[model samples]
Target: MIETINSSKQAIALEDKYGAHNYHPLPVVLSKGEGVFLWDVEGKKYYDFLSAYSAVNQGHCHPRIKNALVEQAGTLTLTSRAFHNDVLGPFEKYITEYFGFDKVLPMNTGAEGVETAIKIARKWGYEVKGVDENKATIVVAENNFHGRTSTIISFSSDENARKNFGPYTPGFIKIPYDNIKALEEALEEENVVAFLVEPIQGEAGVYTPADDYLRKVSEVCKSKNVLFIADEIQTGIARTGSLLAVCGNCTCEGHCEKQDTYTKPDMLILGKAISGGFYPVSAVLADDHIMNVIRPGQHGSTFGGNPLGAKVAMTALEVVRDEKLALNARKLGKLFRIRMQKLVDTYKILKLVRGKGLLNAVVVNDTEKGSTAWDMCIALKDNGLLAKPTHGNIIRFAPPLVMTEEQLHECCDIIEKVVREFEK
Candidate 1:
């Protein structure tokens, strides 16, 4: 084993020497985390603003989720899909019922969950929808960030993700987000099986669509006999005000089928906080009619429904409900925006504040090539908060759902101070 490093400088040097340069992370080298706070290597404390891209929504190293993972690990870890594991059945049933879906297909990561949905949609198109063989198309939004997988990145409009990533996969049509007319036009194309989209475009700088965007799109897809697939990996599980961003204004303790406010997608893709950042867990939920298309042996993963992950996911979801994270996010998100809006009014450098729930962002008055947002983020970090710029000019600020109002207020103070003090 390698010798322990004591300083942030040592850690950074090691990463530069050994790790791939794919990511440009903030300079801080974090060593510990709790509910809404993180501690760097030198013991500098700061509020966690990003939540690991919304993966740690339930909070960092949540105790209940940790206990569940440890307990399951001590008993059984991986009994793979080759055989039935006790935890998998219960977890599947629990998740299906919890999300108001007929079935759940477990996966190990958000990208894999998205990939599974695509495969399911394609198979359903060929078998049930009677689409021509090898001619099915799935329409996606222009500025979407579904995943970095070869097929998922194929339809990306962002050159940074798509450049040199091909010979790209085909059968995907791109359309502008929040455009009902564009969605309608895309549906007109023959053999269109699904419209895969994020409820709120997280990686696209927390771009929230119109209030009724999902409902209208669902109606259009329903009329066109196409599946409405919602990629809620970052925005689901109480990260948004509701359990799912597509749930709209419904903040009920659990998903309510009676409430029409919830724009239920035909397929819901969930990940990230599904295990409360304790384990890599994700799932695709669908009704039997669409899910039944995939027979046994058609698709499976070695560690998809492992007992350890299942237990962690079950407990993680329980934490979301039991701790009332959705209600907390709704309450604090309003206050957060109000506070940020004040900064927007005072600071000419800030263009606007936009987002629903804690998944929010502020647009800097700078070109994409400029470094204003990045500089402000570094300032915020130095002043005891951690956030990062998304698409250059936009910096996303998403804290854990378990954060208290008082802690949120403190973070807002740090943000305001950073903005007011930023020169460039």
Candidate 2:
């Protein structure tokens, strides 16, 4: 690896030469990271405002989590569900109890967790909800970012994500986001089994719905007897300042509080921070009826419940509670957004800054579709804050959950400088 990666430029050139051009990532070659900061190959440092799309909620290379990974790796790694591993059972117990779910079906990626949830929901629809065999439809919100799986993209409303990707999978119907009316209308069709949605559409530029939108949607799904599935891959694990973003409360505050209507979801899909930025461990959690519906041989993964992932995830959850990242996000997020709003107020090029918790985005002036967001990201990079664009005109700014006040201020300073310069 050392002989091959002699320099960052060489690595970048090698990737450009050999790898697929699937992602148009910012041209910074990160070499090391800790907490909320990262260093490029040339030793130039930048505040990590993206946090691997909210995967590092526990921070980069967290010590305790790293210890767990190292320890478990030395003990046991993969046992492949053919036989039960000691760590998997205990890990599942901790996770389900922590999340208040009766059981958890683990997977290696957010997208796979989503696929598992879809399978379980469809099966439940057939067996429990009583939808027709193959015709059972799952309602999804337009512009939602679930994952990049084929079936996921089939229901996607984004033209770019869907073009040339199918021979699409059927049985998903896209409804307008934030519109309770569209959801209600969709549910009018009896084949609706579940409604899969992101609490805040993160990849679509941290687009949060109206305050009561979640409550209203949950009520609609409840009234219609359809399961409410929350794809919290990006928004879960305190990214939005709650255990789950759909919990509707950040900072444990009742700001998202409501009657019994807004309290729960039938299926919860989690990833990113589940392993504390260590490995790719994701899961689908549900109560007895929904989770139990999956019998042996129904669903499984090679690395899903592996001991390494199990230990890492358990410690990761503990670190979140021990470090109080949720409360920190609540406090820092308000400051971050408030500071960005001030920048927005002063800058002519920025349209608005909006979000909940650390998951936030700035709407750049639509100069020409995607140009403004890309240029602004480049500017932000130059100014020492690292963020990326979602759509053409929106740049999301999500720092690590372990971000400190001083570090957040430094990032905000960079952003302010970039916007001020952009106004020129």
Candidate 3:
């Protein structure tokens, strides 16, 4: 057997020899993780900034969530839908209440949650909203990263994500993001069920829509009788300085203060952090009318709301609230961006920095012309910070919510150090 001391090297070798080469992940073999730090099999430690693509919002292996998983595992794991378990109902109630939705549908992954929502939105369109069957159209945004499901990829404008993946799902319309004019025009089309979007397009380099975008879009959806579904899988769970980015400060420029108005999108899709980086736990939430449209057998997953996920999701949510992660994200995010801007000012290759809350990005200028968000990411990893490039020229810096002010500064220093080397 391969020795554990060389586990990372051995694991990578095995994966290269056997696993499909789908992802081009940074060459970092993690042995264990806690809070915002991960250690390699050789015990070299690094600060994690991507936070598992915003999945580990409460931080890697949060103690409370880990405990919940342990205790629940020893109790009940899966009961399926044939017989309900003890935790599903409680998790449903806890989450629905937290997000201010009338009902909740639990799923295992972000994409699964999105699929559940799409199904619910279409049903709502036909049964309640009174759109004709099989004619419901959902509006998505260009450059939006909803998920990689076939139904999702059908509307994706990205060539890489959609290349050769066909025949694709239909009934989705792609529109330019942050353009209220296009959205209004699309809403006028008949049989339009919902406007499914991310509050802040995370995979698109943490692209935040124009200020007042969410509230305005919410108004548009309401006036046109189309559901506004926010796919918060990456941007929710306090990643964006709020319980949900859509909620904002409840007083921020783009957000709605009243629970009655909070862009409360007809449907709310959640995943990732819902399990605090443990088991995959996703949820779809909506008003009764919208949720009621999905009949039981029509939508269900074997591992969707199993007992283990339920317990993990319950505790996972509690960590976000109890830790005041939203406040921390907002406060530290501001500092991080400010510090990044300062670094940008001192370097030419580092072109710009922009983002909201803790989900931020730094644009790298091309040696020839274009931006270099990717090359610098390699340099960043070498400097003991693990971040990935988005598109080509944008590198996102999203640490776990467990990051402290001191640690944030240290990460900033590391970023500044690596970025200065890129300056030509």
Candidate 4:
């Protein structure tokens, strides 16, 4: 058997030598994780504030999801969509019912789910809306982080993601996010098939839009006959105080269509926490009319609807509902913001705080190119809490939904102590 590596320095050195230089992760080397805490290679524990970009909203290595994965692995893992597995049908049915959709097309990653939705929308535009061949356009927002795929980066405004990556894909229009007038104007263009947006722009430093933004978007898409696709991969699954960010202010535990705040999309794309970070599982949900456009063989994946992922996803979602994670996130999120707001009032280093539910970010009073936010995060890690900076000067804080109120307060104390030290 291979010898186990015990030193954090050794692990970091190994990764630096063998791995591609794509990610600049925090310096801490994690070895184990539980509900709201992580242990480093050196036996130090820290609060997990990032939650793997909201992928572990149900918590790390959750027992229910793990049990389902273990049981499914012992039976059947994958049949490659060449043959039907016993779990796929049940998973599709359960997920559709859970989200109140007519059907669900399962995939393995958030990027794959996004690609699937793009194909479906384009096809529906051609066959149903009668858009000219090769003329269909999908509108997306500026500064949005869908994924790192080539097609996704084609429409990206981030020069770092787009530099030297051309010739970029066409048939996409970029609009300023949270601007209804710009959306209305863009919808006036011919062959605009859909408007794809994140209910809350998570990667753009947890930028929550206007409260009525999604509701208005739904109305505009309906009027323009364009598909409204909400990419809730990061903001869904109770991350933003509701089952889905599109649920808006609805207080229900699950998707409730009758609620006034509910802004139903033509197509919904979900991933990340859909499997509670135990496995890679994503899905696209739509009604019969829009989804029926794609016939057999037009789209599929070898591991898309595999038995292992399906079972884990089902159990993960069940945990979210049974534990009332949405309600918990809603309650704790308010308390977190209140605590952070006090820091902003007391410290000159902080500029402001803005977010929904547990997904929050604090803007540092420094330039985007400054290292103050990075330094603060390093200090936080040293103080036994983990967080990361986004857009240079903003620090995002998103713990697991399973985090208790007492743990949240303890984490807050750590953050406060770090801020005090940094301010000095």
Candidate 5:
């Protein structure tokens, strides 16, 4: 066996020497993870507050998901879309029935799922809605974090993501995220294909929209003959208190369509927690009317519907429902905010806390360029809880959904102590 690297210094040196400088990560070097906790190379344990950007919502190395992955790996791994795999059809059926969609097209990552949705919407516009070729425009929100692909980044408003990344793809319209008026106005424009948005803008510091935002937007899109696409990769699979943030208080463990609270979208894009972070698995779901627009030859990925990923995704989703993670997240999330709100009221450095379910952020009352949030995160890590700052002054806190109420209280205590100490 290769010699075990026990020192954080050695691991950090290896990454710095061999890896690309794309990410500026927290100083701690993690070695193991399970449920809501992570251990560093130096054998230090810390509460996992970020949950791998919500991909580990089912928790790291969940036993059932792991068993599925291992068993499937022993049997079959990759058999591309060129050939049929035994698990693909079953997995596809399971997901459609679970989410109440007619069909699902699997991809490998969240970005690919979003790209697939875009392509389908554009094609549907031309073939079904009668929009002129190359004139189809998809509406998006400001500060959206879809992915780093050339086509996806083309419409991003972030200077860091958009700057120097041109010539960008066209046929996209940017609008204010939560502004129903702006969305309606954009829909008025000719050849509008779809309105794509995250139910809760998780990357934009857990920005929750107004209560009626999703419902109203769905109504607007339906009225205007524009497809309403929900990018629920980060907020879906029980991460946002429900199966999806778009589910809108629907507590049913089964199909979302049956529930009165559910606001059905034209296209549902999903990834991240789909495989419980066991493997890369993402999918786009829609009814036959919209999904049938894309001919087989027009779009496909080599590893899109592989058996291994399919098996993992199916088991992962079962865990979400069987464990009632949505319900758990909903309960713990409220308690987290209630506790964090007390800290916010006491401390001058914290601005406020806002989010749905386990997805939450506490904004720092400091300038964007200031180091207060980052400094606090360092302090948090030192105090045995792991969290990181986003966009300079926003610290996102999204622990795994597998955490119990008692564990949540413990994590809250750790966070409270860190904040109090930082203030002092």
Candidate 6:
């Protein structure tokens, strides 16, 4: 019989002994989660502020999504792309219509979705845009966090993620984020096929750009005849108070192409919360004109369009729409910012607070090398909330979107109490 682990210390030791040290996770051993709260092995319950990096926007173990997974699991889990599955067709139709895209190519993870978008863009460049073969180049923003794949990391400005990971893949051009002139200049190179960017720089400490940045980018890409790819893995599915971060300030429940704030991208890459943290599911969406460039065997994943994932993702999206998570995120986000701004004004330890929706960040008034942000997160853990730091000094707070206003106020109170005690 297998021995059961019953303590946080034991769980930590088990991971330390066996797991790779790639991630320096916060020392919290979670055993169960429901809605916006998690229970440690010791039965201590705490509010989950990270929401698995915005993958649980529908909250943990969401019954609707969970039921979908279970029902599909018992029926048809996967038939692979070699044969058609009943769920894949419906899912494709649902998601494409949901996002106002002509078609969608399903993939398994956010990184895979990004990789698929890159492939699609390059193919569209060669077949559609007449870019020279083997010379199609994609433009990316500096400090962008797409994924850790070799090709994705090749253009990364973070040396820590890039160090010793070369000789890196070529054909990528790096430009400053949120700068229109720089993008125009890069597009002048003639070989630039696509401009890929995050709607909001989530991993780079929730760096929300100017309101007009994406709108202007859309115009520029159209004029230059280059594909504009929005990697919304972290910011999509109502996490940024919109269906997609590229939607800007639009309050629509679904993709509204007619909305003025909607800066539609040529290619949309979505993942993370697409399955509500229940399973790994991702998608790359585009219109027929651009997506038709992909031919059979050019790209595929075995688990990409599996039936179980399809059902779960469909239900997950339904939850977001039916519950109007985007509206909630928008209202709660305003409240969160107001609460955080007050703390920023009064506390010397806080530098500033910035973000949209529930994906806010509080920058500690210390250097990037300082431990203050990490220390504060630890303090929050002890006081019944869990958050994590990014870029050393910025602590990101993205709780489940299902969080109630009363619960939000309670969490804010905990934050205030922790800050007060820490300052003393």
Each model's lDDT comes to: 0.93, 0.86, 0.86, 0.95, 0.92, 0.94
Higher-lDDT candidate of 1 and 6:
6
Residue lDDT tens for model 4, 1-424: 6648889999999899989998999999999999999999999999999999999999999998999999999999989998988999999999999999998999999999999999999999999999987899999999898998999999988888899988899999999999999999999999999999999998888989899999999999999999999999999999999999999988999988899999999999999999999999999999999999988999999999999999999999999999999999999999999999999999999999999999999999999899999999999999999999998999999999999999999999998998888889
Model 3: lDDT to the true structure: 0.86
Off by over 4 Å in 6: none
Across 6-67, the per-residue lDDT of candidate 2 in tens digits comes to: 57788799889989998899989999998888998888888898999999988889999998
Q: What TM-score does each of the candidates earn?
A: 0.99, 0.96, 0.95, 0.99, 0.98, 0.99
lDDT of 5 by residue, 1-424 (tens): 5646879888888889989988899999988999888999878999999999999999989999999999999999997888898999999999998998998999999999999999999999999999999999999999998988999999887788879889999999999999999999999999999999999998888999998999999999999999999999999999889899988887765545777778989999999999999899999999999999878699999999899999999999999999999999999999999999999999987889998899999999898899999998999999899999988999999999999999999989988888888788
List, residue by residue over 289-367, the lDDT tens digit for candidate 6.
9999988998999999999999999999999999999999999999999999999999898889999999999999889
Question: Candidate 1 residues 1-424, lDDT tens each?
Answer: 9869899999999999999999999999999999999999999999999999999999998988888888888999997788988999999999999999999999999999999999999999999999988999999998999889999889988898889979999999999999999999999999999999999999998888998899999999999999999999999998888999989989796778788879999999999999999889999999999999999999989999999999999999999999999999999999999999998998899999999889999999999889989998989999999999988999999999999999999999888888878844
Question: Model 3 misses residue 207 by how many Å?
Answer: 0.9
Pairs of residues clashing in candidate 6 = none
Candidate topping lDDT: 4
- Mark the regions of model 4 whose C-alpha exceeds 4 Å error after superposition: 1-3
On lDDT, who's better, 1 or 5? Answer: 1
Clashes of each: 0, 1, 3, 0, 0, 0
Q: After superposition, how far is residue 264 of candidate 2 from its true place, in Å?
A: 0.7
Q: What are the clashing pairs of model 3?
A: 49-398, 364-372, 373-393
- Tell me model 1's lDDT, rounded to 2 decimals: 0.93
* Candidates 1 and 2, the one with greater TM-score: 1
Pairs in steric clash, model 1:
none
User: What RMSD does model 2 have?
Assistant: 2.0
- Model 2, 304: alpha-carbon shift in Å? 1.1
